[model samples]
Target: MHDNLIVIDGLQYSNWNRAIFEQLKSGGVTMVHVTIVYHEQIRETLLRIGQWNRLFELHHDLIMPVKSTADIYLAKKLGKVGIMFGAQNCSAIEDDIAMIEIMRELNLMIMQLTYNNQSLLACGCYEAVDSGVTRFGRQVIKEMNRVGMIVDMSHSGERSTLDAIEISQRPIVISHANPSSFHAAKRNKSDEVLKALGESGGLLGFSLYPFHLKNGPDCTLDEFCDMVANTADLMGIDHIGIGTDLCQEQPISILQWMRNGRWSKEMDYGEGSKSDADWPKPLSWFKDSRDFPNITQGLQARGFHDEEVAKIMGLNWLNFLDQGLQAQKV
Candidate 1:
């Protein structure tokens, strides 16, 4: 592991527990942005946050809440994992725009405009007709900028994601997704989106989820790193980081909650075929948090310098948070 690195995973929705926390420590991970809400409403979201509060109380020695860049440094100084919260969809806020700031006050640092379907704010990748950002989305983006919360476009459609990148004053991010050019996954972004993200000073965290990888469960470390290098050439090394999208220890049944939520009575396969209802087999080298070092090694072997490797592993995210998390001066 790169001991001096400030490793941060931009997104993960694992079935978190003490065991995973320990693995993060063993892997030298310092910060992680975790999903607090998918399609949950405000009350449900609050309950999830309450659950996390209990986790913090019970596992104080292992993890701490992070609402700012300073909190991340504090966690690193104490050798604890900083758990930052994010929402995979805008459902938590419902139809109320004011809830955006309220969610920020509650420590939600990142929020996606849509998940895999059309939302009040924007259109998701799975939608047949992507109308792009709605009027409410523009307002939400402005509010997010004012409050220093990141606008994430990870699961949004091409037009919607591009619209968000152009509309937001602050640089937005695709918190966890790959380039569609690599795998042609619906959730993966396009070259236009990637270029716009880089030109706009945004970031893209590569996903490790089988559905997003070019070769699914069989993707090699070399292939993954090569994709990283290729993406870096387009987006700049500073704008790329690891967001593994690790769903560790989660049961196969949870896929329904993630994809279908309450919106559909039937199971939503998302990008998966019928067999994808179950979690795909994890990459052999990165089956859990403890395997992060494999990526560091892979990056080095792919010809990235130590500093660049450090940036990809975590420092870039730290810099991004420093610029994106400060509440704008009134």
Candidate 2:
């Protein structure tokens, strides 16, 4: 059953290598959205893409760039993983709406408006007072819609996220985050936001990052599936999919780069955890891409029909991106 499924992890950042790509194949992963730049500017963003270009060149047999929905089908047919590039912050655009189209043409198809901090476009989840979308953000969203670039609010504030959904004509996405009701984490979405996301034709890719889960690294497959069930009831099953915010084999030093990102010299541990200095221990049942099948089995055990399980696993993402990746009709 799992073998025939079209598995897609909506987000993941890892120390890329032959081993991880092999793990993705072993797990039956057909495509994955990989983070390109967290806080990089235009030139740096290009450099990061160049780095991935090297990866695709070196690992040609195992992975291919996914510029459109068709690329995903091609990857599956060829038994290679389709890699979609996404910027974790709008910094690559740097207040210029034109960069959206340029980056999308470069195959950087998704860009989050913020990354846990207020940006030129919008306020991030960690902000005390949400400014919602700025004047530039409104245009950015419109231009993103005109082009094929996706507007991702995974790290955005409540007001900002809701503002984005209202402002954008295209169906945006929270590419990686869980429900606040599931864990009450600052990074998680409120029920109000989730409801609006579903109603607005957007999608929510559930995160597997331990900090976003109820029991942290000890969160069981059953507990996680229960959260999915609840979210499905709130936001239809077609609007939900997996985005294992999996950061495997990355060094602790990279944490400072992600959170601090040249803005501050301080160690930015936003939440609780004695292991805040390091990566939280991985969930025992899903330490790597190879364990993706566990989620399929867990959903089935929780009473989801095979078809429903298929959507949450990957088809939903495929269907969403099929239309989401196309340029708007003039």
- For lDDT, the strongest prediction is 2
Clashing pairs in 1: none
Give lDDT tens digits, candidate 2, residues 1-330: 788899999999998999999999999999999999999999999999999999999999899999899999999999999999999999999878888889999998889999999999999998899989999999999999999789999999999999999999999999999999999989999999999999999999999999999989999999999999999999998999999999989997777688889898766876544456678889999999999999999999999999999999999999999988899999
Give me the displacement of residue 272 in model 1, in angstroms. 1.5
Candidate 1 per-residue C-alpha lDDT over 1-330 given as tens digits, one digit per residue, 9 for 90 to 100: 487789999998989899999999888899999998899999999999999999999999999999789998899899999999999999999999999899999999999999999999999999999999999999999999999999999999999999999999889999899998888889998999999999999999999998899889999999999999999999998899989999888886777788888989877788776765688899998999899989999999999999999999999999988999988788
Report the lDDT of model 1 for residue 32: 93
Worst 10 residues of 1 by lDDT: 268-277
CA RMSD for every model?
0.9, 0.9
What are the lDDT scores of the predictions, listed in order?
Answer: 0.92, 0.93
